[model samples]
Target: MEEEKMEAEDPNHNNWERRPESPPELPAPPEPAAPCRRRCDSSGGRALLGISGSTSKFLMNVITVDDYRSTYWPKLESAIDQLLTQSPGDYIPISYEQIYSCVYKCVCQQHSEQMYSDLMRKIACHLERVSQDLQVSSPAHYIEKFNLALGQYMGALQSIVPLFIYMNKFYIETKLNRDLKDDLIQLFTDHVADKHIYSLMPLLIEAQSTPFQVTPSTMASIVKGLHTLRPEWVQLAPTLFSKFIPNILPPAMESELQDYAAQDIKLQQELMQNGFARGDQSRKRAGDELAYNGASSCGSSQGYR
Candidate 1:
């Protein structure tokens, strides 16, 4: 009964909770299909029963990913180089399948760290060249050129982002990490956008306040583009819509004073009247209690005398 009560108290309890299962009865060993069988041959002997390459590798304990790393690393770097050197508006044909395969192999080989580091370095170096190519001496044209180069680079890197994320499903995402697109955005901002694009916010707002060389549409695009680079820092909506709050704090007594200010003379008079009447009623009640106590004291003293 106690056990039944305990089980009844447990809302999730069920009659068929899991327990150790008894071992199932095994079938008798099958008869050998082959005429002859070999046990562990070392002299390049034929496999006992239709052994494939992977099966042979498993048997011999020769399975390794060193060859995969060696084979794919150079190809990966070469594709990145092509991405860097390709001409403007000329789309270099990239074999996405091969790149994804390389990344997948690297992940399989437990070489994702090396691959990620190499990718960061290569992409950073290439982006440095892009930043240099788009450098402008004029502060006025700085935002324009940086933005243009940023767009071009992003367009170029569009094809490569998918391949970089091929390994994200298995390893990178589980660690609570950023993805390839986010990394690329960081690289671009660090190398290119941070210098010219992000620094223009106050200046751009100033210009928006007044007339400027860059048109309103271009300025809008600049703000939008900056948002794409760093979302937290870019809030052009308030600036664009002329929405602003003065930094000056309200007076300390503003809340109490505002209530008084909100009331007209007639309303204030009515409030004072109600408060005075309540106070008088309380005082009158106290006076009546005191008089009754004095009378009771006098009557008791006379009766005692």
Candidate 2:
């Protein structure tokens, strides 16, 4: 009875005795929506999604090696011909910017090796032609022609090197560990200068020995030009003179010099004899004139007295 009365007095007595009601079941969470699928279009090769149309076209339309060669090589060849054939100081017919673009594209397309090889071959051919032309020149004119050709070729290279700067820096310098200009110069030396060096040596020696016979400027041009193409030639001239002069001079020039020296001595002695005879005659005439003047003065003074 005391427990019941206490329970009744408690405001929570019935609630404590009653079982707690279970919470109503919540509906299952809705399934997450599927991600929207973007199907890539497969026509005309695989299309790059999220890229601009121009970029996509550029990637898709890759230029094959053959295509590059076919489409651009003729243009390049023609331009090179124009560059090589143009007279010194003449305006270039081809556009430098256009060639630069083509070369840049070729290098970017990984065609540098082929392009470099073809360019070298073309240059070698041009040099070969130049060598043949130089070979046919008369010995008297050989140095002049060679100097002219060298100047023209080097001038053309000045125009060419800039056009190929991209390929030269990226492929020639980096991969081959060579300088483009040096390689081109070497080509000229090998094909043109070196081949003719032996034949040219005698003329060069003669010109140097008697510089007055040839224009000093012409001799200087040839020497400087050859030296530029082949630095070793500077030392070579002295070496050649030291080794060959003794043997060569006696056979060729020494006899001529001795003959001229004998003739010169005879002529000089004859001139000296003539001079002395003229001096003696002048002295005798001066004495005679003085004696006549003295006689004339004496006669005049006597007559006056």
Candidate 3:
């Protein structure tokens, strides 16, 4: 009775008969906070990640002009040289994909203009070297050497175009409003073709006059190359022949025709047998047809047909 009275008086006192206390109720789980929306910078740049503009700029390792020239241009230039110099059977020092990535990075780093200019300068330098070499070649071998160099340059360009496709799209086509391949071809015209046109003209005339002096395929390539370099010439009246030939060969045409006429049927047969003719026609007939076509075309063109 005394203990019960004491427990009642002191509420803090424990009693064995009392029920165990229940665990305190946990605070209701907090409602999930709404997701924070990312905000893009005013300049249309990437979304900010709590970083100040200056800090973001500082963090980016933007390549400078000098940095690109020193770090990347040399490697790209070396790859181009390898492509231009290597023969079909030779080993390539750099892979096409590596060169392409280099160009792509340059363009991405805001060096598109510099990269474009550098490539143009490099190609111009190469054409200048080719021009110098051609200038020293003997007349007997001039066309052959020119054709070989042209083929090499063209082949190298085919490889280069794909490698620089990004730069071509971003810088060349967009900013300069020019086609890379066309510009390169123009460089060839300015650096090589124009410089040697006078000397080459006589060779072309001689080849035409003397049937076997240059193979027909070689002649065709020369003609096609000239036409390709000066597409505007195609707009001229005599679309049948390379316009440069007509523009330059007017004085020699009559003489060339006379010489062709004087050649025997045996010469014509030889020409036809040598794949000069277009199809399975008789050699004599094809040769006569070729002669007639040549004469008519030459007659129609004031300068070139």
TM-score of candidate 2 on Cα atoms, chains taken together:
0.59
Write the residue-wise lDDT of candidate 2 on 157-195 in tens digits.
Answer: 877787787678777887789989899999999888899
| Local distance difference test scores for all models | 0.53, 0.62, 0.64
Please report how far candidate 2 places residue 148 from its true position, in Å. Answer: 1.0
- lDDT of residue 86 for candidate 3: 60
Q: Point out the worst 10-residue segment of candidate 1 by lDDT.
A: 20-29
Q: Which residue pairs in candidate 2 have backbone atoms (N, alpha carbon, C) closer than 3 angstroms, thus clashing?
A: none
Instruction: Report how far residue 221 has shifted in candidate 2, in Å.
Output: 2.4
lDDT by residue (tens digit), candidate 1, 1-305: 43343234333434333221111222211212121112211113334446776754443322145554455677688767766565446555554445554565455435666777788898899888877766644667765665566666666566566566645544455443767767777898898777655455666766655444556566766666666677655344343422222212232353444343333334435647646332444556777877865664443232111
Best by lDDT: 3
Each prediction's total of clashing residue pairs, residues at least 3 apart in sequence or on different chains, is 0, 0, 4
**Model 2 / residue 65 / CA error / Å:** 1.9
lDDT of 2 at 138: 94
After superposition, candidate 3 runs with Cα above 4 Å error: 1-61, 88-91, 232-305
